[model samples]
Every structure is written in structure tokens, then in C-alpha cells.
Target: PVVSDFKILKNAGVQEKESFHPLRWFSLEQNYPNPFNPTTTIRFKLPNRERVWLAVYNSLGEQIRTLTLNTLNGGTHTIVWDGTNDIGKRVQSGLFFFRLQTKEGALQRKMVLLR
Candidate 1:
């Protein structure tokens, strides 16, 4: 039988509740501790498993670091930026942008770093 309304019934006595698979689309959340010192965390959600390309860019729109370039499972995931580049060199304090790209599309957000 087809299940409509994006839900299913449990036991006869139990009431219907929202499903656990709540994520329906791709999303990128802002980094915590906006003006972080040593590190910051980035979070994102995926509706399905797909290849992800996440990177951080400078104010000049130049790529500074490629955080991830691999397939991630469907669900919420987290990444941490340690104020360093791909070469493991520390970056200066400034505004930066991070982009999360997937097969569905792309999402971008800005963050700040404090020395």
C-alpha cells in the first residue's frame, strides 16, 4: 500500500508522529563561535548520500583550503577548520567564506577568525 502525508502508522493505539528522517533537502549551517580563535565547526545536512566538495575561501574569493572531497552519508555532518590552510600553515585573522557543494546544488556562508 502507498503511504501518503509522509508518515506511517505504528501500533493501533500509538499516535502518528513525525518521522526520524526529517532532512528533505541539502543545507549548510553557519559556523559556531563566529569570530573564533583556534578553530570553528561547520555543520551541514544531506538528504541522500552524494559526493561533497567543501572548501574555505578568502575575502579575495581565492580558495584557501579544501576541507572535503569525498562521498558523505545522508544525514547531518560536521567539519572543523583549524585556522590553517592545506599546507597546515596558519591563516591571518579576517573574514572568510565557506562553500558546501553537492550534486543537488551548493550553499555558502561567511565566518570570521580572530587572531
Candidate 2:
């Protein structure tokens, strides 16, 4: 026979039990205006408070710039990317990617830049 570990609470002759469920976190979007000339926005959401880092990279996997890095509360947030590098220098027109890393998982989406 198998035994399960569970506890019951009684308050004034009433009994109560508790249960648990798993949570799943995810990001919901790809940026618009890809192949943009100047700027574009990236949006995502979190299910709980977590440390997050958002960055942009070139096709070669080299990080171009960091858009955000901090602990954020559960909700939606957006970041704008101006076609530039970490040094504030304008980048060339080509394929790029926006990446998000959090306690749950990592995600990446492709974008483009145009002169």
C-alpha cells in the first residue's frame, strides 16, 4: 500500500485542505516593423517577479546592446531599440535578433535593420 503525506487543518470543528499546482512562464511576441530604418519596440510579459535581461545581437551571436537588466514584477513591458551599438554608433542594415533571458527560460526573435 502507498501512503500520501497530507495535513488537514481544523478551525472550530471545520476541516480544510490545501493543494498545489505548477506555474508556467512565457513571453508573447515578436517585434514589428522589422527591417526598420530607425527604431522598433519589443514586448514581453512575466508571470512572477524575476530577474530579466534583454539584449540585441547580430547574426554572428555577438551581443550588440543591452536594453534591460533588472528585477521586474509580473506583468508586461516593452523596450525600444534604436539601430545602434553599445557605443551609440549606428549599426549597418542587416539581420539582427532580440533576446530575453529570465529565471524560467531564454527566448530569441529575429529582426532586420534598413538604412
Candidate 3:
């Protein structure tokens, strides 16, 4: 390797962030307003582009609503659940679990919906 003379450029450009930090693993964050009445937001992160499956299930582990079933880019994503079922019917108030699935694996979290 040969070292060539180089000069530092002053204020050439600056990065928006000090450093770029990408998601290292797939994960699901807890839904905001855990005990929600009408709607709640679900957030997840993907290290790479992949097919995603987000759904809500009852305490019995029965899937009631399919929030998202598509391919998403590698980044943080969010979806809103309006406390409804697959058929657009409002569900009863109780403790429910939401699951996020991708090729990497699966992650689930609990949320409650109140009528």
C-alpha cells in the first residue's frame, strides 16, 4: 500500500446522526397505551427486508385479526390495531397477545383492549 498526500476538507458535509446505527435484530416493542380502548400502535424492527406477519390472538391463542401480511423494508415499522377482528367486528375486553413473525423468527407481546 502506498500513502498518497491528502488534505482535510473543512465543513464539507456533516451526517444527520453522529453515527448510523441499524437494527441488529428483529424485535417487537410493546404497544403504546397498553390498556387501550379504541386503537393501539404496534411497532417492530427488521434487520433486513423480509415477509412479515402481524396478528392479534385471544387468550386461547386463536388469531382474531390479521393486521399485516406483506413484505416490508429493513427498518422500524408501525401498525395500528383498532380493536377489531378479521371480519371487522369489535372484540371483547380481555388480555390478548400480538405476534410478529418473519423469516428470522417470531416475537409476541401482550396487550389489553377495554370496551
Candidate 4:
């Protein structure tokens, strides 16, 4: 005769790993003064440490300038786009887009440049 030992594992209903911080939806606020003159402020927030990239693009989906490109901490941050290209050349007044991308996700906002 052989004796068998069986053990049931409990607490299986309990979670083990820590849950993520409430996903603070990242946002791209509208550039102040719809038709910004010389400069404008762009704002965004990060819920955790992530590689952030903030750039400006023309209506044609062309990258105009890169405002931020580095590892950032979890917090709110802002950058100013002076309505210029990568070479410091002022762009023509038209519709533009401010894009933000991170490990979390990506967000895009529309802006206007007024000469």
C-alpha cells in the first residue's frame, strides 16, 4: 500500500504583483492664442519614466522640429515651440501638429501658426 500526500494551494484569489498607477491619460493642450504669433507653449504629462519625444510637424506630416528627445521622469512637462524649423528658420503661417510619444502611448494636437 502506498500513501499519497496532496496539498491545496490557497490565496490563489489574491493578486501578487503591484498594480500600475492610475493611468493618467497623457494630454496635449491646445497652443495658447489659437493663432500664436512668435512663440507658444506646449504641455504634457507622464505617468512614469519613459522616453519622451515632442516634435512639430507641418500639415503635410513632415517633421519640422524636435523639442524634446530624452528620458523623462514621471511628471508634467512643457516645451515652447517658436514656430520655427530645425534650422531656426521661421515657418509659414499654417496648420501644424504637436506630437508626443512615450512608452505609454502617443498623442497628437493641432495648432496654428500666424505670421
Cα RMSDs, all models: 8.1, 8.8, 6.7, 7.6
lDDT of 3: 0.94
Number of backbone clashes in candidate 1: 0
Model 3 stretches with alpha carbons more than 4 Å out: 1-18
Clash numbers, per candidate: 0, 0, 0, 0
Q: List the residue pairs that clash in candidate 4.
A: none
- Mark the regions of model 4 whose C-alpha exceeds 4 Å error after superposition: 1-23
> Candidate 4, 79: how far from true, in Å?
0.5
As for candidate 2, its clashing pairs are none
TM-score of each candidate structure, all chains considered together: 0.82, 0.77, 0.82, 0.76
Evaluated against the true structure, the overall lDDT of model 2 is 0.87
How close to the true structure is residue 5 of candidate 2, measured as C-alpha lDDT? 66
Candidate with better TM-score, 3 vs 4: 3
- Residues 62-92 of candidate 3 have per-residue lDDT tens digits of 9999999999999999999999999999999
Tens-place lDDT digits, model 4, residues 1-115: 2335655678757767987666476666777767799999988888777889999999999999999999988788878888889999999999999899887678898999889
In model 3, what is the error at residue 59, expressed in angstroms? 0.4
Give candidate 4's whole-model lDDT: 0.86
Q: Summing lDDT over every window of 10 consecutive residues in candidate 1, give the lowest-scoring window.
A: 1-10
lDDT of 1 by residue, 1-115 (tens): 5556467558758588977856789999999989899999999999889999999999999999999999999989999999999999999999999999998889999999999
TM-score, structure 3 vs. true: 0.82
Query: How well does candidate 3 match the true structure, expressed as C-alpha RMSD?
Result: 6.7
Runs off by more than 4 Å, candidate 2: 1-23
